[model samples]
Target: MRAYERLLNYVKIHTASADDAECVPSTERQFDLARPLCDELKALGLTAEVDEHCYVRGWLPATPGREDAPCVAFIAHVDTVPDFPGEGVKPRVIENYDGGDLPLGESGRVLTVKAFPHLPKLARRTLIVSDGTTLLGADDKAGVAEVMTLLEELNEKKIPHGKVAVCFTPDEEVGRGTAFFDVLRLGADFGYTIDGGFEGEVVCENFNAAAATVSVEGFNVHPGEATGIMKNAALIAAEFAAALPADETPATTGGRKGFYHLTDLSGNVETATLRYILRDHDAGKLEEKKATFERLVASCNEKYGAGTVKVEIRDQYRNMKEKIDETPFVVDLALEATRECGVTPICDPIRGGTDGATLTRMGLPCPNLGTGGFGFHGPYEHITVEGMDAVVRILHAIVRRVSEMKK
Candidate 1:
């Protein structure tokens, strides 16, 4: 079966993860996709199972003469981002795209070439998009489909390759994808996360990330009695936001630039909370970003009261490049595989984090591979059928190259 076919079937199942959920999988609905994926892997003659945490793991032994080659693992996440509506995704398939502005079904949302300059390059290719109501789940689902198709091709064609391991993870959209991951058990020497955008992307570096929650406490008073004593928390929170560098934000920054993104803010006159995610490719710069938050909180407290403002900062993940550099072969092999498949290699640093970032730190040394997906995390999400096919071919090439490598 083709990779896009699998993506169409997988997107119909709602697997949007919740950010507020405290469970390992974050949502029980993730199991909806995990169970079937495990079953599919089992049917493919591989040992596969879905764990309690909704991680679907599978392994296929090396071909007869390739036993000495290093084991290679592939990973993809199952859950879509909770920030957008992820349920009821109705995908629209456009055969031979004309590279013009296309309107989504009835919702009045248009995918315009002017907005997305890459549309011209995708001309004449089959494109898949969602009805403007929800996300298409192609961010990682396309990756999942490509990996599945790779396995099927390797097995049916009797392709010579090393041991192939795969894991379909849950809650990746919520930053907890690897919280319960047991790296020692899956046991692949090195891996690739099939969770990236575009056809030829090979990502090794990503942002060092951290999340901050700034809480404000104020004295609420009647509007008529509002004087110097009344410190409105909402106003203070707004001030805090204004203090941030306007140019250093998700909207303004691009390509290796660090940013402070305010993801959520809620409060009243008495109390207000601001949640921000800080990201930078450099660990030192990330620490500086965190320190900026601390300084802001201190400045606010000094003006109001000693304990008027408080901040809680938590480190999410670090750049994987430090770990990936130790074993440069992982990236080198991916680039070689991409070139071997006639796809020009795009080795750009990821603007965001991936499951591979945490996995690489956990000793897996996994880099990221693209699944031909674009415009992720919203209704505008799209992918090309030809792009997914290219990824599957690249995966096969990577396996073949590994099989030919000396232990």
Candidate 2:
């Protein structure tokens, strides 16, 4: 079966991750995908296991002469982001796409060349999209299918590849994918995550990220007798929101730029809570962004009462480039593979975190590769048949090249 067909099949399973869940996988539904993946790997004559954490792992033994070559890995996430509807994704295929505005489902939604002009390059190829009611889940499902199909190709063609390790992680959308992952068990010298966007794009650097929670304690009193004694927590929450630099936000930031995003807000007069996520590729800049929040919280406390507000900032993940620098060939291998497939490689810093980032920090020397998806995490998400085919070639080239490389 084609990779796109595999993608459409996997997306039918509802694997949307829950936010702030205490468990490793976040939701048991993630196992819906994990279990099947392990079974498939086992059927392919590989040792596969599905642990309690919902991580699907499989090993493809090295070819006879390739035993001394370094072991490599391919990683992808199972859970879709809860930020959008991930259930019952009806993948609409636009075959032989013409270079013009293509109408999606009802509601007058159209995928136009103006907004996504890069689409012209995908003309005459099959485009997999949603029906305008839900996200297509191509964010990582495309990655999953591409990796799966590559393994099948390697086995059928009897390709001489080194020891190949594969992992399907859960809850990456909630930033806890690697929370229970066992890098020692994975046993790969290095790996590449196929969860990136666009063909030939490689991601080695990702944001130094943090999640913050700000709480406001209000002193409530009767309106008639509330003179100088009542403080509205909701108003303080609004004030806190207003105080941050309006220019520094996800909406305002782009390539290599950092931002503070307000994710959730709740509460009223008695107590109020505001949640914000911070991101920056540079460590110093990330610290500055965190300090900026601390400064803002201090100012709010000073402007209000002393004990009126409290803030907690927790580090999420750091840039993988620092770790990738230790062994640069892992990235160079991907670039070499892209060229081998006749695609120009575009190396860029990740705008968000990935499972690779966590694995890199855990000593796997992981980087990221593209899944040829764009406008992810929303109904606008899409991937092309040509794109999927290209990535498969890329992965195949990377593996075969790695097997031939001298450690």
Candidate 3:
């Protein structure tokens, strides 16, 4: 099947990962995509295994005469973001885009160049986009399809290479894909996560991330008879969120600028809860951001009475720069592969976290490669057919180069 066909087929599976689920895979339905990947790997004569949580693992043996080379890994996540509806997707391939807006779905939805200027860049190129009624699921499934296609290509061509490990993870949308990943068991000298956007973009660094949850307790009394006795927990929760800097949010900042994102808030007059995500590229600033939240909570508790406000902050992942420093060749190989594919390489810090970020902390030294997608986690999500194929070529080149590095 073609790359676009693979993407279209994969999008039909609903793998929306949940942030609140306690399970490793978050949602069991993600296995719908993982199980079939295992079968495909086996068909290509690779050793494949699928776990209960939908984490699919495969090992492609070295080609003849390259058994002693250094092993490398290509990683992708099978889960899609839960921010949009991932079910009942209807994808259309616009062949030779004419720099005009393409209407999606029967709902009269259109992806206009006026809204996204990047649409015109793909003009005259084939692109697969959603019907505008639901998400296209290209966030990382595009990465999965590309990686699998490359593996099949290598196998069919009898390309000489070292051991290559493949891992299709779950819950990446909720930032937990790497939580249950067996890094050591997979056994690679280094790896790359093809889970980012843009064709030439290579991300070896990302923000230090943390999740903070604040709870407020208040006593409720009849408002008519208890004007002073009634405390509104929802108001207190609003105050806690308002204490953060106004300019730091996903909508307000870009390119290394970190911000506090208030993801959820709900409460009544008696109780309320506020959820926030803190991020920063600088370690010092990241710590400061967390400290600011704690200080705000402490101050609120003092005014609202002791134990009235509580804050729980959890560190999610740290910047991968230090980890990449220890394994510089990983980034180098990514750059080399991009140039070999005839794409201009652009090295930048990821404003958000990737599974590679957590894997780096786990001692894997994983960097992120791009899948040439844009408008991730939203309704305008799309992927260009040529961009997807070029990335596949890049992956193939990276694998061959890393094996050639082996003495």
Best by TM-score: 1
Give all TM-scores, in the order shown. Answer: 0.92, 0.91, 0.91
In order, candidate lDDTs are: 0.93, 0.90, 0.88
Residues 1-407 of candidate 2: C-alpha lDDT, one tens digit per residue: 77898998998999999997899899999999999999999887689999999999999999899999998999999999998888988989998988677777883678888988888888898999998788899889999999999999888989889999999999988878889889999999999989889989898989999999999999899989989888999999999999888988999989998999999999899999999999999999989988988898889888887989899999988999888899999999899999999999999787888788889999998888999998888888889988999999999999988999766
Comparison by lDDT, 1 against 3, better one: 1
RMSD of each: 2.3, 2.4, 2.4
Lowest summed lDDT window (length 10), candidate 3: 99-108
Native-to-model Cα distance after best TM-score fit, residue 317 in candidate 2, in Å:
1.4
Q: What is the lDDT of residue 59 in candidate 3?
A: 97
Which digits, one per residue and each the tens of the lDDT, describe model 1 over residues 1-407? 99999999999999999999889899999999999999999999899989999999999999898999999999999999999998989999999999888899999999999888899999999999999889999978999999999999998998889998999999999889999888888989999999998877999999999999999998998988987779999999999999999999999999989999999999999999999999999999999999899899889988999999999999888899998999999999999999999999999898888889899999998999999999999989999999999999999989999998876
Q: State the lDDT of candidate 3 residue by residue for 1-407, as single tens digits.
A: 55666898999989899989998888989999999999998998889999987889999998877888878888999988888898988888889988778887675878889887878888888888888888898888999999889888888887888899999999988878888899988898889998888888899989998999999998888888776777789989888888878898889999888999999999998999998899999989999998998899889988888898998999888999977898798899889889998999889887888888888889888999989988888768888999999898899889889778763
**lDDT measured at residue 38 in model 3 versus the true structure, 0 to 100:** 95
